[model samples]
Target: MSRPFRSVLYIPASKERALEKARELAADAIIFDLEDAVAPDEKVAARATLSRFLAEVDYGPRLRIVRINGFDTEWGRGDALHFGALAGVDAILVPKVDGPADLDAVAALTGKPLWAMLETAKGMLNAGAIAGHGRLEGMVMGTNDLAKELGSRFRADRMPLQPALGLCLLAAKAEGRVIVDGVYNAFKDEAGLRAECEQGRDMGFDGKTLVHPLQLPVANEIFAPSPDEVTLARRQIAAYAEARAAGQGVAVLDGKIVENLHVAGAEAVLAKAEAIAALAE
Candidate 1:
């Protein structure tokens, strides 16, 4: 089973305090942000700080993805070359990836698995090619930038962002890569955050990228398979097994048909639950 990324928190690499504090957080993954979080003047120093921190400290079980500056920026190439072969880094997240060509540029600098930030209109349009890139392992929604690019207003349901979100999501799924939802800006609002987490979970996001530690519990709880879901999955699997034993193609479970497809989904739910359980250990 794949690792669960239910709560991915972004920690500014320039802040020693934030990096130290992140070691204790229950987030499934940590994005050591080297892009927007760092100031232009501090960018160079932040890289050294992050490299030293990763070498000296241990962030167990959780993934360590470094989000490098976009190739459009002067610092982008340096960021990639610096963190590309860094020991603790798990993946290199390339921001504003417009197509596989963008991945190609970064791939030349690093042999590490890549993650793309699908924020631009052109990136969203070329999502399929980007997601299919051999080195790409995941996709992250950059909603704030995408909104700015579209000159769109924020709605409670994020209706304006649906098309872009769906396009990237479909592309990621088609290519069998993990896709996470964007951060909800109002980090302090627990109710609003929970609502959005539920939406992302229902929309098939592997997780939600978080802005603050306060948002972790809600995202983790909402994204994880619920107790009822686990129970239902167990029942479905049992029913399907019994049907197959009887040389039947489908089984009736709680008035619904359970076929091989349903069993496959049920297995995935159980596998995810198991994976989440293991993450806690």
Candidate 2:
């Protein structure tokens, strides 16, 4: 079964407490951030700490990803080399990824799956090429950096970022790669966070990157199939089965046609839900 990567939580490498607390969180993945989260002087120490943490922690079934410094930085190579050596490390997240060359360079260096963070205008423009690059497992929306680079204000519906978002989704879907939406900066605004999570789900994101623990529930709720949806999916599967037994080629349920494609989609949803529930238990 494909692992469920529904809620990705970012923890600062320098914040030991936050890193420790991650063990108790329900996020599907934990991103050990060494770029924007660490100061220049703290980079060396954070790398050491993160290296030790990765070597020691089990992180249960949650995927472990390290967000290394941009490849252009002085400490980028060091961070990549150290974190890439860990046994449990699932993927390396490369920040400010501009093109396929950047992704290829990192993938070659680490020999691990690379998640390219599209955070700039150049990155957005070349998203398709980057997603198609070798060893690229996914692309992440870096909304804050994209907004800063474009000098555009944020809106509730993300009108300014629609094109970029759509492009990333298209490329990711084409390559069968995961696409995670960016974090909502406001940790205390639960309502706003939920709204944005719902919007991300509606926009075809596989999941969302979260900055705080409170956002975990919202992300999980938004990404997981709802009760009504699950019921409908179940009905679709049953209808298809009954039709096939009756030697009927076409099946209709609730005035809508149910084909192989619909049955496959419903099965996928049910499979994911079952996997998540099994993991929780």
Q: What is the C-alpha RMSD of each candidate to the true structure, in Å?
A: 0.8, 1.2
Q: Against the hidden reference, what TM-scores do the models get?
A: 0.99, 0.97
Candidate 1 stretches greater than 4 Å from native: none
Give the C-alpha miss distance for residue 238 in model 2, angstroms. 1.0
Write model 1 residue lDDT over 35-121, tens digit each, in one string. Answer: 989999999999999999999889989999999999989999998998998989999999988899999999999999999999999
Taken over the whole model, the C-alpha lDDT of each candidate is: 0.94, 0.88
Best by TM-score: 1
Cα lDDT tens digits, model 2, 137-231, are 87789999999989989898889989899999998988889899998999899998988888999988989999889889889988998889889
Model 1 gets an lDDT of 0.94
lDDT of 1 at 55: 94
Deviation in Å, model 2, residue 236 alpha carbon: 0.1
